[model samples]
Target: MSRTLINRLSHARRPLLALAIVAAALGTAHAGYNVWTGEYTFTKDELQSAVDKRFPATLRYGELVSVRLSNPRLVLDEAGNRITTRVDAALSNTVIPSPPVNGSLALNSGVRYDATRRAVLLDNPTVQDVEVQGMSQYREQLNAIGAVVAQQLLKDYPLYTFKPEELRFNGKDVEPGAITVAPDGIRVQVNLR
Candidate 1:
């Protein structure tokens, strides 16, 4: 009777062991999905390239006055959580044949994710600085013009966009929470909706 009982206990342990293994496997898979919050990173070159494509933009106040901005350079400000774009600028008066005032315009901007667009956009951009080669008298006016141009060009400008699948994970919809500027790149927080 003792040998028969021992054999029955061994048979019961085998099924229990198999059940435990299956339970652990399922738990591991669930944990893997739960552990993911979502972090999207983009390199400096990628941001720079996005900015470059919009450039050589001309803002005209009238037929006589126009400002052309081109050759943008993007700088990530990790500490400020902002970005800086410096573009070569040429302000010209169609009436004046003397020459175009050549200089560079610098803009500082924060970022936000637009759900409707599924893109990261430049938010609340301001004219950080302006340096013109020969136009010392018109610096103030130039700064104002730069602000308007920057607003039209950079405000809500998409820095990065997400595909339909990129925002969906494990059959769940996720959205961008916050944007962070890093030394190497930009980091976006993702959260479930």
Candidate 2:
């Protein structure tokens, strides 16, 4: 064995070990920093604007009458790992040969992500509560009225559509996997692919 070669090898081993340690530390930090987890929150006002745009201000059941929605309010809930939304609307109905009927409508709905449709859907909106002002004479018809209004209002509406280009991570679009309804707003959890 040559003494010079052995001495050179021994000196090189220290730097090699140091380089390996530095590489490991850098890898750990990169992994920690590169975790792409983010939530997109949709505020109440934003949802209201969307609803206003998607649905009409006045809907008619027949030629003789029409209902108008005003002062829309939203309440969000997280149930069974899904989103449940309730919309409270001030309703004003105008009927021919009658003045007008004013009331409040509480529309309860479940929100779900439809994989096949690639959209966020509001499913089966039902009237959780209905308040009719100055209509005590027709109390028995309140539920029926509310149900019809709800059905007509939210028949086939998609609250959100997944545009792969819109949801992005690191300048590349990502797909969202889950949505949660919170008190403050709706949160969409995006996955980085």
Candidate 3:
């Protein structure tokens, strides 16, 4: 092989080697580390089992037709040991009612479930009219639907009461629209209307 050609081949090989190293590093960071830490030991079935045990009769993953989470609060207890968590969650979906309705319906509502207190203390609900074959249902049915939605939301995302227990918070009763849980911590997002 010509000297110039050999040199060019060597330069190309260096980049190829660098690219291979980078790819291996990324793979290790994404998946290899999980294997070493035993984080990947929990299979989807195992996770679903745990979640189902914690939240029975609640929709899991794709079963959730709609969901809205709002108003989160995180606070330290008087003892400053555990963290208190509170949030209002709203959810809705279609299900085969006992005496199944021939048509579909819409439900909506909000609820405050406190993990510390292990209680559902606050519920705010509203429902919209659902027409079946051009015939509108009673407002009471709509309200019932809303209540069901709220109850389901509570069931699905039960308040993390354990946080307060762990933090040693006083765990006082919470009110509606008072606080909420955020991605980072308890944060209230103000809306100017």
What lDDT does the true structure give each of the candidates?
0.85, 0.62, 0.37
lDDT of candidate 3 over 111-192, digit per residue (tens)? 3545446532223433333333432545555345445644564333532232222222124322222334332323221111
Q: lDDT tens digits, residues 1-193, model 1?
A: 6999999999999999998887676445433122334577778988998888898898897677788899999989999999999999888888877578889989999999999999999999999999999788988888888889879999999998888877776699988888889987788887989
Model with the higher lDDT, candidate 2 or 3: 2
Q: How close is candidate 3 to the true structure, as a TM-score?
A: 0.27
Model 2, 81-159: lDDT tens digits are: 3333334344444553565667777777766667666666677878777776877776667677678877777654677
In order of lDDT, best first, we have: 1, 2, 3
The estimated TM-scores of all candidates read 0.79, 0.62, 0.27
Q: What's the alpha carbon RMSD for model 1?
A: 8.2
Off by over 4 Å in 2: 1-38, 62-65, 78-96, 167-174, 191-193
Candidate 3 or 2, higher TM-score? 2
Which model, 1 or 2, shows the larger lDDT? Answer: 1
Candidate 1 ranges with C-alpha deviation above 4 Å? 1-37
User: How well does candidate 3 score on lDDT at residue 139?
Assistant: 50
